[model samples]
Target: MIHILGKIFSIISIISLIFAIFTGNLSQLAGAMLDGASKAVTLTLALVGTMGFWSGVMCVLQDIGVCRLLAKVIAPILKFIFPENCKKGIATDEIAANISANMLGLGNAATPIGIQAMKALSKANGDDGTASDDMITFVVMNTCAVSLMPTTLIALRRAAGSANPFSILIPVWICSVVCAAVAVFFAKAFALFSHAGYKMKNARDSAPPKTRESKAGTE
Candidate 1:
């Protein structure tokens, strides 16, 4: 996928360059590129303090046992969503940490925690190449995670000179919840369908072969 995306981007860039040259807009394109690069750097620098502050807050929360408290609060819900993991008692802590980090809108912090959780889950699943139901569900949840405080987005808005940086809070909450719910629903539906198919295949494989006598009797 990464290779495919790289090729697509290269093709687009080549086409854009061709168009710019044909239209005698090469200088304009070059200027635009420089401007975009400058803006990217500026944005990165602006976000640095906000990101660092949130990261520090996350660490402080962990140190003060707030993360653990949040984990305990969400334990039942996690158990319900991840019965297999709960049964094995594997990856529970990592899963909780990942979820807590996401809720706090600490995506960068959540990423490493999420990776650890995935590793623990994969191990619990016997390290199978194929993703299990729990893995699919967890991935979906992580991708569409509900963020109670989208600090990164707020910081971007502020950097962009929004009159009210926090104005998106309500919309973000609604969108995240809806997205997470829909994603989980589809993941679960697919998992059930796959499980049913697997069972059918297993039953077919385990069934006894029809003998000549049985064929004759049926005829």
Candidate 2:
């Protein structure tokens, strides 16, 4: 589906650019766009090379079991964020592993590990109707996660000829951390409300229901 959408968008963009050229209103602008794309070719290659280097380094770390060890260290933190798993006695080791990889700014490495972790979490939940609170919370937590190092962003900025590559580190850290914290807090708040409601419904259903005749006779 994503590939199909990409193909559609690519065709649309090519058609729009051709239409602009044919209309003659965008002659100079089109020329400038072409120049920019030409200039970006070298920068794009540099960025890809940097990313590839870092990704390879991450792979080496993974092979050496350093990443798994790091994951074990952070498992407690992950368990706190995903309490339903704790309640269900479902291990989140793979998730912890994936998160540790992400923390090191290796999102690609984290993905397959996370997918496996999700499968494990689902199986532990033992039902298919709705995802468990832990699963939802984990999704939210990962989606807005605070990255330790913006390695890819820094690499891209450098490739784009920035004067200082690491200049934005402090600001990025502050903003990403704040956003991650807010996201996790909201997820936890919603999970709490959902759990309370579920428990309330369960209690209401389990208790004896009052009948009109029984109440009248008691009165």
Candidate 3:
């Protein structure tokens, strides 16, 4: 679906470019594209700097075994969400770091660690390119992570000249908690339903076939 959307957008962009050229507005289009690209580059650089600093901090924490400690701390929850087989090792550490970064509102810093965790999960799932129950649950948690600091929002507000930059803190916290709880609840509920369905299917598949004598006796 996402690939299809990307292709659709690319086709629309090409058509717009052609129309602009035919209408002799190519220069204006080029200027707009250049301005957008320039702004994108600037934003990319800003994000890179932020990601670098936070990633370095995460690296230091990992070097000092903080990620491991955090993994241990969150082990029970992780075990409940993930498959019993994949609950240990670097995957758990990556998840811990990702969650830590998210709580601190350093989502850029969390991206790489989250990717690593997904890779670990894929490997655990036998590289089938299908999302497992644990993967789905992890995605739910990551998407709805409770942001305690929301530093990015605060910075954006400050940039926009807000008088009280941190005024959104309480609202952000409340919203994050509520949304995360709701997302987790639904994801777990679906996971349980899917597991039950699979178990029933397996049970039906393994049941004994009725013989001719058994069928006649039943009749």
Name the better of 2 and 3 by lDDT.
2
Q: Which ten contiguous residues of candidate 1 have the minimum total lDDT?
A: 210-219
Write down the worst ten-residue block by lDDT for model 2.
Answer: 210-219
Candidate 1 residue 191 C-alpha distance from true site, Å: 1.0
In the range 85-150, model 2's lDDT, one tens digit per residue, is 756656577778777887777777788988887888788767585787667777887898667778
Q: How should the candidates be ordered by lDDT, best one leading?
A: 1, 2, 3
Measured against the true structure, the TM-scores of the candidates, in listed sequence, are 0.77, 0.71, 0.57
Give the clashing residue pairs of candidate 1, or none. none
Model 1, runs deviating above 4 Å = 1-12, 18-27, 107-109, 197-219
Q: What would the per-residue lDDT of candidate 1 be over residues 71-139, giving only the tens digit for each residue?
A: 788788888788867988888888888888788766767799889888987887779787878888999
Write down the RMSD of candidate 2 (Cα, Å).
6.8
Pairs of colliding residues, candidate 3:
none
Show model 3 residue runs off by greater than 4 Å: 1-76, 83-90, 195-219
Of candidates 3 and 2, the better by TM-score = 2
Steric clash pairs (candidate 2): none
Assess candidate 3 and give its TM-score to the true structure.
0.57
